[model samples]
Target: MAKVSFDGTSGFEVPRHVAIIMDGNGRWAAARGLPRGEGHRRGVEALRRTVRAAGEIGIGILTIFAFSSENWSRPQSEIRDLLGLLRLFIRKDLSELNRNNVRVRVIGDRETLSDDVRGLLEEAEELTRNNSGMTLVVAFNYGARQEIARAAQRIAEAVVSRGLSPADISADKLSEFMDAPDLPDPDLIIRTSGEQRLSNFLLWQSAYSELVFMPTFWPDFDRTTLEQAISEYARRERRFGGLAAAGT
Candidate 1:
């Protein structure tokens, strides 16, 4: 992969892909004595800011955890509100994203979504498929366990149908069956709201990702916060179970 130059910074390694677990919307809203819906609304604004910031910082790909499969277990009213916000974001922001040359890619279980929502997700991807700028991957209705299970099922079917031999299955081969197989694994995974757990997001892709847990809530995250996270990532040495480089 070609290294992205952060302008005038000599020998600084930046993460090519960054994934975020946006959390604590409800807590933020509760602290302010406002409804959770308000927190989600503000969270959307934070996302907009972060997207532009990621592009400005030369991040090649930004993947955000928008909705998890377990999120469906939440209250129906809250789910409705969350879905409404998603609709609003796409309908109102798609044009701007396209104009800015940002490509939108959605990964998840699409067959389980409502028809209209599924169409909108596809539209977002199709409209920006040719964009050359930073790619924004939205993980909606996604769960890593479910994704892996689906991949396994596909591999099994291929073997049973004589499309693939069982002996040929390998980790790399199985990865091709995953959602958004073209996307590179995230180099850094940041979880806001001081969360210390993965919470079933990007289990496979985050195998070697540097994890950062920020105390700021999702609604409070901004460009500076993102930069700080990146700086933290840069300070650490990733060994991938091997010895670190000579210098610190």
Candidate 2:
């Protein structure tokens, strides 16, 4: 991916990759005296809108935190509802996404998922595998710590099986074992509902990502909200731990 830095003279440039932590669905529902499921449904709609807007704005990749491994701790009924929504979203939106030339990629531990859920995810990826447009990454049943641990285990296994030297392991080598090594690290990460933390999303990949937090809930997110966040991103200087340029 090409670097998108602030030129300081030309118009602002769009990020090559943007990741979002869709937060506050339950809180949004609670504020309106509705069930949490309703907020999730609306959040799905917001997701659709965001994907379209990202493509229109020339973003190369967009990653969404759809579900986390820790989400299983929620009420059983709520868990079922979330799963149902995932099924519904794929069934209804998969065809449209494919027609729009969107390539879908799912990352997480899938061994423990039900057969049906796993099938749907695979179908989405297969159907859009040849797409050359924007890539949409869904982090379902994901935990950053778990991902790193899994990579470490794989590296250890390689050393035992292939005689790979333990001393050969480096940060770059470990990254090659991550779920999606081809995708670039996120240039910007946005969280809605005023949240200020990463919440274990993309820990290894977001080392230099500019974060934008908004008070608007997930269900209320739209293209305007995304544009606002990108506008904020354009004003900042990214040194990446180096000294700033000679002049502002």
TM-score, predicted candidate 1 vs. hidden true structure: 0.95
What is the overall TM-score of model 2 with all chains considered together?
0.95
TM-score of each model, paired residue for residue: 0.95, 0.95
Question: Any residue pairs clashing in model 2, and if so which?
Answer: none
Off by over 4 Å in 1: 1-11
lDDT comparing candidate 2 with the true structure? 0.92
The residue-by-residue lDDT of candidate 2 on 1-248, one tens digit each, is 43333334445689899999999999999999999999999999999999999888789999999999999999999999999999999999999999999999999999889999999999999999999999999999999999998899999999999898989999999998898998999999999999799999999999999999999999999998998898898888898988789644
The clash numbers for all candidates, in the given order, read 0, 0
Residue 140 Cα positional deviation in candidate 2, in Å, after optimal superposition: 0.5
Candidate 1: which pairs clash? none
Task: In angstroms, give how far residue 221 of model 1 lies from its true place.
Answer: 0.5
- Model 2, 77: alpha-carbon shift in Å? 0.9
For each candidate, what is the lDDT? 0.92, 0.92
